[model samples]
Target: MTKAWAEEILDWNYEPPYDFYNDNNKEESMKELLEAPYFAVLNDSGNLAGFYCIGYAAQVPLGYLFGAYQEDCVDIGLGMKPELTGKGNGGSFIRFVLEQVKGSKSIRLTVADFNERAITLYERAGFKKTYMFAGEEMSFFVMEKRSL
Candidate 1:
């Protein structure tokens, strides 16, 4: 997420705070995603489209529903190039990740409540809201998908 790109998500209203990519810290962000089991999305021409990282986290944010569920779970983050937002690439990107995590029984992610478009997309991809929380400045849905 670049500074310009982070600004885009900020426009979505009610989104949770994220480590908006500062030009200075951009390299650090890329370094983390460039490294392992992460799936890097690419275009038909072989250019990178976006990237996602999957793992387990007790909670996406501290004190936001704090801690409850654990064990066999997947956590993830994804960002498509800003220009690609309305282009319909998310569904496929998520499907690809699911294919890679095929043997896992569940996957989880956090989405801010103000992002209606994103929430709808996840629902279409089979994720169901399992938990929700609202803090002084943000609200979010903690969703999960059972193995397909």
Candidate 2:
């Protein structure tokens, strides 16, 4: 991801229930987002729509204890521009990401259990819940979609 886009993302502040998704540490988040696995998503107007990361960068450390990433699948982590969330953009946005990774036989992702909006979006994109694990303060679900 470009530094400009990363900065924009760091500035995004979601409202109440979704506030947890906001980036609190600019330095750390910038470092991660600029790494190889992460990519920027732009809308039709060429504005930053969101971002996604693949493989190890997408995994949650606590999930390892539950064997959530044991399977051979392309792990994915993603975020939408806060203002676009819950506004009927999720379906297409997810489809775009899916298309980008269409060559993969399997795809997986993790989502906070409390984020019904994201869980529902993932389910609609054909992801099925495969595992659930508790974090220090919350819980997360490992979901997968397979083409084979």
Candidate 3:
């Protein structure tokens, strides 16, 4: 169910060093959008703190979800208001994503190697390194968390 505080979290720009699903790839973007299930956080006053999008549930990532493994695992993307970063909000947000992703083989995601802060948060959120992929343009860490 969409929570009362969810609206505040609903508005966000997930663009960054990784730019997880943005306007750049318009052709395939809408397809991914359809697959996302949103989760929101509430403040003490019951206002929304932030939100994230988890893809690959009954929801599909356009067609991206199909090629990347055939099980029930989800690919996660999240953001807090830029002003709310580094004070542990991100860690909690990631934990929230993990909670939503609970069950199945595992959750998978790619992180730019240079984004050490995010990498640390992922590690704290129980993500483990699965592989490293690099190209002339960038390098990333392929991380996964096995389901209990």
Candidate 4:
């Protein structure tokens, strides 16, 4: 992702409950986004639709202790523009992302258990919960999709 796009993503703010996904540190977030395993997604109108990251950037450190990511899978992390959420666009967006990572035999992602909307979306996208672990304040589930 470009610095400009990363800056835009860092500025996005979500409502309560989802606000935890907001970026609090621009410097650190920018560094992560511009580094490897990160990419920006744009819509047909060329607007920043979302962003995704692979590997370590996609995992929660605490999950490692619980053996949540021991499987051979492509771990992915993604977020949509706050304004675009809950508008019936998630399925297509996720499908597009899965297509991008279709080369992988298996894909994995971690999600907050409370975010049922996201969990449902992932399930619809063929991701099944494989493990659950507690975070500093909440709980997270490690979901995976196999055979592309």
Candidate 5:
């Protein structure tokens, strides 16, 4: 990922009623991008559209409670440009990422239960809820999708 994209993801945040993204120090965030399975989503023009990470662990605080460490089911963490949210582009962006990782047997993602919009997008993409739990300051759902 480019330095600009990394900075964008590092600084991602959401509005009230759905304050999901966390603010991490630059050093830690940059280290994650450099070491994790994170990948940048690009627009047709090759600019960053968003970013997603595929792994058996999550970036969320207390994410382990959501089973983010299971090897059998890969986990995904993602974000779109803060300015691009609520614009009806989420589903397509997720689909685009899924297409890139379609070879996996199963995939999972944890969404803050209050992030109803994200939950809807995941449900529409065929992810079924595996469980729910409370963590830090909010509730979360662990959802998964399987490939045949």
Candidate 6:
């Protein structure tokens, strides 16, 4: 992602309806986004739609979910622009991202329990809840999608 797009993404905020990631501390958020190895998700016109990181869950504290860093599976972290969410395009967008990943028989992602919309999107894309993990601030479901 370009520095400009990364800055824009770090500034994206959610309203009360989507408060799952509601953090008032922008500095920490920006740092985390910038430090993560993520790729820009661009729209058809090539504008940044969002950003995602492949296999990040295995490296973060969330590694507990994989029983000390399993390498046989792929785990993803995704963030869509706050404005683009709930506009009826998430399912297709996720599918397209999945298509871009290479050489993995299965993919996994973790989502906060409060993110019903994201859970629904993952479910529709054939992801099933494998287990749940409790983080310091919230609980999450580790969902998995196996290639058919």
Which candidate number has the best lDDT?
4
Ranking by TM-score: 4, 2, 5, 6, 1, 3
lDDT of 2 by residue, 108-131 (tens): 999999999999999999999999
lDDT of 4 by residue, 50-128 (tens): 9888889999989988989888889899999999999999999999888888874699999999999999999999999
TM value for model 6: 0.83
Question: Which RMSD does model 2 reach against the true structure?
Answer: 1.0
Tens digit per residue, CA lDDT, model 3, 1-148: 2533333333344546534422455434444443447555565786566656665432223334334344456677665665576677786677766776677667877667787888898888889877665666656676777787
lDDT minimum window of 10 residues, candidate 4: 96-105
Range of the 10 consecutive residues with the lowest summed lDDT in candidate 5:
56-65
In candidate 4, which residue ranges exceed 4 Å CA deviation?
none
Q: Tell me the TM-score of model 2.
A: 0.96
Scored by CA lDDT, what does every candidate get?
A: 0.62, 0.91, 0.60, 0.92, 0.78, 0.76
Q: In candidate 1, what are the lDDT values of residues 74-93, reduced to their tens digit?
A: 77656665557656877887
Query: Weakest 10 consecutive residues, lDDT, candidate 2?
Result: 96-105
Model 2 accuracy (lDDT, Cα):
0.91
In model 5, the runs with Cα more than 4 Å from the true position are: 57-61, 65-71
How far residue 50's Cα lies from its native spot in candidate 2, in Å, is 0.6
Q: After best superposition, candidate 2 residue 36: deviation in angstroms?
A: 3.8
User: Residue by residue across 1-148, what tens digits does model 5's lDDT show?
Assistant: 6677788777777677655476647798788786777888889998787888877435455766665445477678888887788999998999998887787478888888888888999999999887777865788888889777
Worst 10 residues of 6 by lDDT: 57-66
Better of 1 and 2 by TM-score: 2
Q: Root-mean-square deviation of each candidate, in angstroms?
A: 5.7, 1.0, 5.1, 1.0, 2.1, 2.7
**What's the CA error at residue 115 for candidate 4, in Å?**
0.6
